[model samples]
Target: MTAVVNVFLKEGVLDPQGKAAHHALDSLGFAGVSDVRIGKQIIINLETEDRATAEAEVKEMCETLLANTVIEDYTIEIN
Candidate 1:
């Protein structure tokens, strides 16, 4: 099984890199662009055949290390 984790800053938080990218886009004459937010993707392949255990482990991994819970949010997808 494969687990995919997507980590992103929560709403109301400031993302400097995203801001810079947005600014650059505006400067490049992309007027339709409004906002840009940055996030990260992590892919993990598990050896376990049990879907329940794999999901539990992946959630634990996200909570423990993959994401900053205070300022960041995450979503999980299992395949």
Candidate 2:
């Protein structure tokens, strides 16, 4: 099974990296980019074939190690 996790900052959180990227884009003349939010993607290969089990395990991984839940949110996809 393959699990993919996308982790990103919460809406109200200030993202310094995102801000920097936005500024850079503006300087480079990439106009009309109103905003940018940075995030991370993690891909994991699991031995289990069950999609339910993979999702559950990946969710746990996100909660325990992959994300700081207080400031970030995550979505999980299993295949």
Candidate 3:
């Protein structure tokens, strides 16, 4: 099983890195680039016979280590 996790900061949080990228884009003459936000993605491969088990484990991983629940949100997809 393959699990893909996308972790990102919640809305209303200040993203300094995103702001820097936005400024850089504007300096390079890219107009109308209003905002930018940065996030992280993690892909995990596991040998599992049950899809539900894999999903539950991945969710636990996200909650425990992959994502910061206090300031971030995550979504997981299994393939």
Model 2 misplacement above 4 A: none
Error of 3 at 22 (Å): 0.7
Which portions of model 1 show Cα errors greater than 4 Å?
none
Give the alpha carbon lDDT tens digit for every residue of 1-79 in model 2. 8888999999989999999999999999999999999999999999999888888888889999999999999999887
Ranking the candidates on lDDT from highest down gives: 1, 3, 2
* lDDT against the true structure, each candidate: 0.96, 0.93, 0.94
State the lDDT of candidate 1 residue by residue for 1-79, as single tens digits.
Answer: 9999999999999999899999999999999997999999999999998999999999999999999999999999999
TM-scores for every predicted model: 0.94, 0.96, 0.94
- Quality of model 1 by C-alpha lDDT: 0.96
lDDT of 3 by residue, 1-79 (tens): 8999999999998988899999999999999987899999899998996899999999999999999999999999999
Q: Largest lDDT belongs to which candidate? A: 1
Q: Model 1, 57: alpha-carbon shift in Å?
A: 0.3
Quote the lDDT for 64 in model 3. 93
